[model samples]
Target: MRLEQKYTALLGDVQRRAIGGGVPSAIGQLRLCFEALGLASAIDADCATRLGRHGLSEGKFVLLSLLRDVPEGLSPHALAERAGVTRGTITGLLDGLERDGFLARHADQVDRRKLLVRLSPKGEAAASTLVDEHAQWIASLFADFTPAEMQLLSALLEKAWRKTDRGAA
Candidate 1:
């Protein structure tokens, strides 16, 4: 069924089962949450498809994106922190990317004990293309919104995100 039909039917069910029209604005919020999940899933699929064309997974692409501008490269620990992953996870990702010729690791000049990650020429090209494509895809989604609508949407999303932040309470 269409998303609107699914939403309407769910809301109707809620109305039938509850008093006062289903939790006083919560149904609409629930609908928005569901819509957001759908959007996220679509974006994930799009990302996977695009990355698949290059034989890269999300982790590998993230490393590529991070390394694209860092000709000097980043330490494994720093890249892990920036990528919001653990040192072990970064190691695994680096292994695959290195094997795929997307990145290179070298001993740091300042700290010989530490290694830094840098992108290969092929990786740089892929990163540039993927970043551009991703930006265009994002723009297409918001192209229909008016400037005011975009501003309102941004503010609302910020507010909602702040409310759900770790220390919000």
Candidate 2:
């Protein structure tokens, strides 16, 4: 059975017992379902393992991912804000990536106080290879789903994520 099905079955039991026990409300139930999405479980583990083989930690992987999407790269503050991490955390991540020769930090042309980050050639190559491999791995996991289904799932998840993001802000 699928991971979600397992969680759903357990939720069914909870729903049945809601009358006797103070079970969660509708919103709470959705929270449970979201928890079951398990982004930190198999998905992170698999990506961590893969990145580990290249001497990259999960934190570094996340940093690299954010950088890869933008060729010009982000400032340290911007990176931290977008990654939902602290400036100190971004510093550490950048230090490691820089030490490993994956990225470079330089003064911003227009604003010297603000630093700019950019991927080195090595970083670009690594990001390209790793992203393709990760995409394939993710696609295989969701192979059972139709294109339409995947699109709907993506839309719903993005909506939920946006809501959560707004709440955080």
Candidate of highest TM-score: 1
Compose the digit string of candidate 1's lDDT tens values, residues 12-66.
7776666655456566676776676667777798888878888988888888888
Question: How far out, in Å, is residue 71 in model 2?
Answer: 3.8
Residues 71-163 of candidate 2: C-alpha lDDT, one tens digit per residue: 877898998998898989989999999999999998888888988998898888888788778789878988999999999988886776677
Off by over 4 Å in 2: 1-40, 147-169
Worst 10 residues of 1 by lDDT: 1-10
Candidate 2 positional error at 64, Å: 2.0
Clashes of each: 0, 0
How does each model score on lDDT? 0.82, 0.80
Q: Scored by Cα lDDT, where does model 2 land? A: 0.80
Deviation of model 2 at 26, angstroms: 16
Q: Identify the runs in model 1 with alpha carbons over 4 angstroms from their true place.
A: 4-16, 19-25, 165-169
